[model samples]
Target: MKVLAAMSGGVDSAVAAARAVAAGHDVTGIHLALSRNPKSYRTGARGCCTIEDSNDARRAADVIGIPFYVWDLSDAFHEEVVEDFMAEYAAGRTPNPCLRCNEKIKFAAVLDRGMALGFDAVATGHYAQLRTGDDGMIEMHRALDHAKDQSYVLGVLTQEQLAHSLFPLGDTTKDVVRREAADRGLLVADKPDSHDICFIADGDNAGWLREKLGDRNPNTGGDIVDSATGEVLGHHEGTVGFTIGQRRGLRLGVPAPDGKPRFVLDIEPVSGTVSVGPRAGLQIDRITGIRPRWCGTVPEVLDGPAVTVQLRAHGAEHRAVVAVRPAGASSEGAPMGVASDGSGSGSVEIELLEPAEGIAPGQAAVIYDGSRVVGSATISGTGRSHALAQTLQRVAT
Candidate 1:
C-alpha cells in the first residue's frame, strides 16, 4: 500500500514513518509548514514546524530512504485553525486549536491532498488506533498508554477521514517507540514532545487574540460578579480570560463570607460579566452538547446504559448516563426536548458522576465504551439542579 505520512519532525511522527517503511508499504514523507514563517516560531528541541523539525524530518526521510517534501499549509492553517480559534475565544468559548487542526487542516485538507497525490492512506503520530468493525464501520480506540491517550483530541475526525487514517504508534508505548527509533538509527529518537500549541509559541492566547482581533470588541472590560448574590465583586480585564470552571487566576481581593477562594462559574460575554462562586457551587450534574460527531461510527439513537465520557484530554474519565433528546421549540429553552408548545431543536443529555467542574460550552465531551470510542459532542451548556430537572422533563416527555 502507498502511504503519505504527515511528518511533523517529532519523535512520534518520525518513528511512525519509519515503522510504515519497515512494514513493507510504499511510503512518502511530508512535513506540513503550518506557520507563515517557520523560522520565526520557537522550534527549540521540543516544538514542531520549526526549521530544526523540518530538517529532522528531511534527515529521517533520508535515513529511511523515502522521498521527502514540505507542503506549505500556512494560509489554510491560519484561516481554519488559527482564525477559528480566535473566533471561538471572541465568542467566550475556549477553543481547542489542536482539535481544529486535526478536523479542518490535517484530516480535511492534508488528507484530501494525499488522496489527490494517489496515496492510499494518510498517517500521523496520533496516539490512537483505528480499526474496522464487523458492520464495516471504522472505529477509533484509545492508545495503549492511557496517560498518553489522545483519542479525545481526535474526536472531531469524520467517518471518511478515519477510513484512510493511520496511527502507527497506537499499539506501542512512548518508551517502546523511542527504543525502536534508536535501534533504527533515527536521530529524533529522544526529541522532547511538543507541550503547548505549535503555532502559539509563547502560550499567550489572550495576547495573540489582541494582536489578531484588535482592541475593538472581545477585549471590552467586564464586571466579575459573585454568582450567589449577583453582586459585582471586581472588574476583569476581559471575559475571554475566564472559563466555566476555573478556580485560579481570579484577582478579586474580596474573600468569601467564610474566607474561601472564589472559583469562576460562568462568563457571560454579552453582559460583560464573569460569575464567581465557592467551589461547591461549581458542581454540575447535567450537561448538554451540540454538533455531535461519532468516531467514524454512528451510534444507536436509543438511550442505553452509562458509558465513560471524557471532558478533557488527560482529565479524569467519569461514568455518565446518556440519553438522546429531541429538538426544542425556542433557542432559550433546553435544546433537549419539544417546547412546551411543541416546536424546536434536539440535543443530548449527559448525567455526570459527581458534578464535573469547569464545564465549558465549546469544549468536546467524548463518550468511550471501553477502548472503543462511542461518539463526541460540543458541550453546549451545563446545569446544576435545574439542568437535571430539565433533562428529566425532556426525556420523560
Candidate 2:
C-alpha cells in the first residue's frame, strides 16, 4: 500500500512512520503546518506545531529514508478548530478541539489530498488499532496502553476515513514505542509530550480567551443565580471560564447543606446566567448528542443497543444504552422514545445505567462496543431519569 505518514516531530509519529517503512509499504512523510507563524523557540514544552517540530519531522523522515514535505493547513485549522473552540466556549459549551482537528484537518483534508495523489492511506501516531473483521470492514479499537489511549480523540472519524487511516502505534505501549525510537536512532525519543491546546501558547485557557476576545466577555458581568431559590448569588468574569461540572473558581458564597463547595450546574450564555447548585445536581442519566459520526460500518439502525459512552476526553466510560432520539423531541425534556431504523435527523441519545457526572453540553460522547468505537456525537443537552428527574426540576428553570 502507498502510505502517507503524518509526522508530528514527536517520538510516536517518528516510530509510526518507521514501522510503516518496516512493513514494506511505500511510505512518505508529511508534516502539517498548522500555525502560520510558528514560534522559533519552544515555549516550555508545547512543541506541537512549532517550527522546530517541522524540522524534527524532516530529520526523522531523513532517518527513515522517506520523502518528506510540509503541508500548510493553517487557514483551515484556524477556521475549523480554533475559531469553533472560541465560539463554543462563548456559547457556554465545552467542545473537544482535538476531535474537531482530527475530523476536519487531518483525516478529511489530508486524506482527501493523499488519495488524490495516489496514496492508499494516511498513517499517524494515534494510539488506536485497526482490525479487519471477517466482514472485510476495518474496526477501530482502543490501544494497548490505556494511559495513552487516543481513540477518544479520533472518535469522529467515519467509516470512509477509517478505511484509509492507519495507526501503527496501537498494539504497542508508549514505553516500548520510545525505546524502539531510540533503537532506531530517532532524535525525538526523549522529547516531551505536548499537552493542552496547541494554539494556546501559554497553556492558560481562560487567560488566552480573555486576551483574544477582549472586551467581549460572554458573561458580561451577569448575575450568578442559585438553582434552588433562583436568587442572585454573585457575579462572574464570563461564561467561557466555567464548565458545567466545575466546582472551584466559581467563588459562590452559597454554602451547601454539608458545607461543600457549590458546583456549576448550568451556564446560559444567552441570558448571561450561571446556575450554581450541589454536587448531586451534576449527575446526568441521559445525554442527547447532535451530528453523530460512525466508524467502519454505518449500522442501518441503532435500536437501543447497549454500548459504553465516554463523555469527555480521557474521562471515565459508563455503561449506556445507545439510541436515536426523535427529531421533534425537546432538547430540554427527557427523551421519550427511541428513533428506530437509524432514520433520524442525525441526533443520538445515550442512557447511562450508572449516572455519570460532568456531562456538559457541546462535549463529545464517543460510544463503544467493547474496545471498538462505534460512533460519536456532540452533546446537545442532558437530563436526569427516574426519581432523580423530579428533584432536579431546577435544572430546567
Candidate 3:
C-alpha cells in the first residue's frame, strides 16, 4: 500500500512516518503549510505548521528516504478552521480548532488530494488505534496510552475517512515514540510538543480574537450580571473574553454576596450579557448535539453498560445513554427515544448518568462503546441536571 505520511515536524509524526516506512509501505511525506504568514503563527517548539516545521518535516522525510513536498493549504485552512473558530466564539460558543482541523483539513482535503494522487492512505502521529471490526468495517479505538489518547479529536471522522486513514503511533506510548525518533535519527526527538492554539502566537486568545474580530465582535463592552440576583456585577470588554465555567480574570467591581467566587454560567452574545454564578450552576447532564459524524455504522440507540461520552478532548468519560433522531426534527420538549435507525445526517441526545461541569456548547461530544468510537457531534445545547435545577430553583425562591 502506498501511504502519504503527514509529517508535522514533531517527534511523533516523524516516528510515525518512519514506522510507515519500516512497515514496507511505499511512503511519501508531506508537510501542510497551514499559515499564510508563517511568522504570525507560533514559532519554535510551540508551532505546528510554520516554515520551521515544514523544514523539519522535509529533513525527517529525507532521513527516512521518502519523497517529500509541502502543500500550501493556507487559504483552505483560514476559511475553514481559523474563520470557524472566530465565528463560533463570536456566537458565544467555544470550539475545538484541533478537531475542526482534523475534520476539514487533514482527513478531508488532504485525503481527497492523496487519493487523487493514487495514494492508498494518509497516516498521522495521532495516538488512536484503528482496528478492523467483525463487520469488516474499520473501528477507531483509544490509544494504549490513555494519558495521550487523541480519539476524542478524531471522533469527527466518518466511515469513509476512517477507511483511508492510518495512525502508526496509536499502539505506542509517547516516550517510546520519542526514543524511536532518536533511534531513527530524527531531530525532533527532544522537541517539545506544541500546546494551545497554533494560530495564536502569544497564547492570548482573548486579545487575538479582539484584534481579529475588530468591528464585527459582539462583545464590545457588555454587562456582567450575577445570575441569581440579576445584579450587574461589572462590565466586560466583550463576550468573547468569557466562556462557560471560566472562574478567573472576571475583574468584577462587586464580589458575590456570599463571598464565594463565581464562574461564568452563560454568555449571551447578541445581548452581550455574561452571567456569572456558583459552580453548581455549571453542572449539566443532558447534552443536545448537532451535525453528528459517525465513525462506522450509526447506532439507533446506545445504552449498553460500556456506553460513555467524552465532552472535552482530555476530560473524564461520563457513563451515558444516547438516542438519535433526524436532524431537522424538533428537539424542543423531545424525550430521549430510540430511533429506528440513526442516519448519518441526524442529531443525537445524550443523557449523562453522571453530571459534568463547565460543559459549553460548540464542544464535541465523542461517544464511545467501551474502547470503540461510535461517533461525535458538535454540542448545540445543554440542560442542567434535574436535581441541580431544582436546587437552584429553591435557592432562587
Best by lDDT: 3
Scored by CA lDDT, what does every candidate get? 0.79, 0.84, 0.90
Which runs of model 2 end up more than 4 angstroms from their true locations? 40-42, 215-219, 300-306, 325-345, 390-397
Query: How would you order the candidates by lDDT, starting with the best?
Result: 3, 2, 1
lDDT of 1 by residue, 1-397 (tens): 8999999888899889988988989999999998898755565876486888899899989988999999999999989987887778778887778878888888889888888989988889989988889989888999998878899998877667788889999998999989988998999988888988787678776666666677655656789888879988889777777777787778887888878788888878777798998766666787887766656434435233447788887788877887755543347653444333222245667878656777788888888887777767778888877765565456535
Model 3 clash pairs are 219-238, 221-237
The C-alpha stretches of model 1 lying farther than 4 A from their native spots are: 301-306, 325-346, 386-397
**Model 3, span 64-100: residue lDDT tens:** 9999999999999999999999999999999999999
Better of 2 and 3 by lDDT: 3
> lDDT per residue, candidate 2, 1-397, as tens digits?
9999999889999999999999999999999999867772135435488888888999999999999999999999989998899889988899889999999999999999999999999999999999987898778899999899999998888778888988999999999998999999999999999888888886678777766777666655577888888989889877787889888787766566568778889999878889988778888898888877777544433434446888878898888888864445457763333232121256887778888887898899998988888878889999888756775566545
Clash count (model 2, backbone only): 0
Model 3 clash tally, residue pairs? 2
Comparing 1 with 2 on TM-score, the higher-scoring candidate is 2
